[model samples]
Target: MATGTQPPASGTDPRRAGHGVRGATRAAIAPRHLRTDRWWLAPAGTAAGLLAFVVYSTWRAFSNSDYYAAPYVSPFYSPCLAENCVPMRHGPNWELFGGWWGLSPALLILVFPLGFRLTCYYYRKAYYRGFWASPPACAVAEPHTSYTGETRFPLVLQNLHRYFFYAAVLVGVVLTYDTVLTFRDEQYAWGHMGVGTLLFLVNIGLIWAYTLSCHSCRHIIGGRLRHFSKHPVRYRLWGWVGRLNQRHMQLAWASLISVAACDFYVYLLATGAFADPRLF
Candidate 1:
């Protein structure tokens, strides 16, 4: 018998074999990736951007103070679920979880939006490559020797993204409500508008864009339909969503930055850093 390399097992075709199939092999390249055109920059930049947001959000979430300014509330603290919340004029006092919950009111509601973004399909790909260095970039070798995919414990939770999308939609509605409240002046009159109002409007717009552009939203609207012609309204709506879906990554980052900026603007107002300029 000849002791030599063996071909793939009988009837097996390399092209048809799915990823992570046992005994799969690749070209033996000495370098991690042959392409040298600044591949590391993308993953590095992504990691830095995500990390900065995480740190800033963590700080703001825990700060508790400066989340509410007259006629404006931070996006991070909408719905104001704690009894100790600074009231927003014309805003619903839908406090729950009781006075016993003494933590930041932001903490009460941040989970839903955070979970939605955390489980976002684009985000999963972003962090997996950026933070986990799973291949880091295209054609790059990952340090992980074995790939279980999302079949394991924590990664398996990504399947709950669809449920999180529902929660995100509700959060968007609440943010819309909050933005509406910003239209009122300190006197609680309805006809007033400030710079904050415009900021709130832009923030809410981005939030809705990001929320509605979700892959889950697209699937829910259009998936499982056998015939597009049978549902013309749905087909049109699905087409709109499909266009937005192509820009999902951009919407995600835009919403993130806008939310933080809206919150920070309110923080400035709350801290008396500057007066909210009346634009009426």
Candidate 2:
């Protein structure tokens, strides 16, 4: 007999047998649970929340009786696309052109969320996380890995962010300017809007909060620069930024909710939901 016969099958030699069994089991059932363990859950949930807020809010906005597509016809739609867009006032709201969406207060606020959702770093995070729900904003499932392929329409909509950046900034300025007009209501004039100055202030606050918490901006502002820590102010700001970042998912969710809720109040005031919003 060979003296080296398989190392005599020592009592402590269970390792090989155990590993073989585990390897065989893994090989047999590995791919089945891949779908459930998908890595895209985080982003998916955040996006679902955003879309729910938008769609519900949009429906409410267009369905209100405070706006329409024509002038002085019960509730009226302010002519929006002309060189002479009227400041919104009392009007009936409804759809027109068969299924075309008519204008209203909801539409006004939608600009901010829609724009922010696209341009936001947090939203990008959500999108990257695979948001494992159904398709949100036109998506149905998270990709197993990176989405390197090219498609049109829905994919192309991502480009809308650049244009929406302009829109969001313009809207922010307009809303701020409207704030100025609201405080000095003693000097009101045509095409001037001063409603919800405080609410608009809230919107601005939310924007700054979201902007400062951004990953790109954070990195731009000493996040990536180690030497900047020598400066007390930079260090302090970075410290707070870090705090926000620690609860980043929280901040992202809260900021979106805050902006949307603030917008909703303004729209409600605009559509006469409340006699006058509690501006305090």
lDDT leader? 1
Against the true structure, candidate 2 has what lDDT? Answer: 0.48
Which tens-of-lDDT digit does each residue in 1-280 have in candidate 2?
7764545356634444345464443334434234544344445565577678767656655664433211111111221232222343322222222222434544444555466566565566465443433233333344345554324665556655545555555555544443444443322333433335555456566655655565554564575665764777877787777666666666666656655555455446556555442222
Which stretches of model 1 miss by more than 4 angstroms? 1-27
Error of 2 at 45 (Å): 5.5
Give the per-residue Cα lDDT of candidate 2 at 69: 15
Off by over 4 Å in 2: 1-48, 57-84, 88-116, 127-198, 223-226, 229-232, 277-280
Best by TM-score: 1
Candidate 1 structure quality by residue, lDDT tens digits, 65-118: 898788888889888888877666655567776765468888999999999999
Model 1 TM? 0.89
Per-model lDDT: 0.88, 0.48
Which 10 consecutive positions of candidate 2 have the poorest summed lDDT?
Answer: 69-78
